[model samples]
Target: MAYDEGLAQRLREALGDLPDVVEKRMFGGLACMWRGNMLVGVMGDDLIARVGPDGMADALKQPGARVFDFTGRPMKGWVVVAGEAVGEDADLADWIDRARDYVEPMPPK
Candidate 1:
């Protein structure tokens, strides 16, 4: 499955000056990593985020949030934000920031 370059680019732009940010192809989409940890990604038309267990649960309560079941097992700390949820700049940035906060402070080398 070909990933969406347009979405990938948008994610990169949102990352700004974050250090050690890298993009990798996975799960038929683009996984945006910070210090070797996956913070946010674009899977098909979905914007997936690793927002930790607590935040993950809360995020799922939102209208377009769903568990990210990439490996057949439903990952507890991950959620997929539907494309509609990220239609605006502020919404997209908020989700990315939340994911980044969860993954930051860890060694990513």
Candidate 2:
């Protein structure tokens, strides 16, 4: 599936001035990596976030967020934010920040 270009642009603008950030293609989408750790991306108009294990439950409680089950089994520590969840720039930035905070401490790959 083709990823959302507008969403990707929004993410790029939101991540402006963030050091060590890079854009790459993955999971049929465009991903933003911070310090070589996967932070966030957009898949077919839905926002994908690596919220970490501890934040999974709460992250899903947010509107338009659900398990990011690319395959049959759902992956832990990640969620897909869709619809109204990413409709606002502030909300999208918050989601991206959450992923960035979780991945920033991990050793780069």
Candidate 3:
């Protein structure tokens, strides 16, 4: 499925001033990487966040958040925040920050 362009644009704006952020296409959507590590992206209208294994459980507890199961099997450490949950800029940025907090410390891929 195609990712939401508006969401992609919002993500771009959120990360605009951040250094070492790059855009790449993945999971049929636009991925924003931090230091070459996948931080966040848009999949369909949902926000894809790599929250790390430790954060996954709590992230999923949030409203409209779920495991990012692009494939048949669910991927641990990743969560998809539904569009409704990210209608606001602050909410969207919070999700991105969760992903960034996890990926930013890792060595670049």
Distance from true location, Cα of 100 in model 1, Å: 1.3
Top candidate by TM-score = 3
Q: Per-residue error at 2 for model 2, in Å?
A: 0.5
Q: Name the regions of candidate 3 deviating beyond 4 angstroms.
A: none
In the range 29-79, model 3's lDDT, one tens digit per residue, is 888888888889999998899999999989989989998888889998999
Worst 10 residues of 3 by lDDT: 96-105
How large an RMSD does model 1 have? 1.3
Model 2 stretches astray by more than 4 angstroms: none
lDDT of 2 by residue, 11-65 (tens): 9999988888999999999999988888999899899999999999999899899
Instruction: For model 2, give the 10-residue run with minimal summed lDDT.
Output: 81-90
| Better candidate number, 1 or 2, judged by lDDT | 2
For all candidates, what are the clash counts?
1, 0, 0
Q: In model 1, how many backbone clashes occur?
A: 1
Sort every candidate by TM-score, greatest first.
3, 2, 1
Model 3: how far is 108 from its true place, Å?
2.1
TM-score each candidate.
Answer: 0.91, 0.95, 0.95
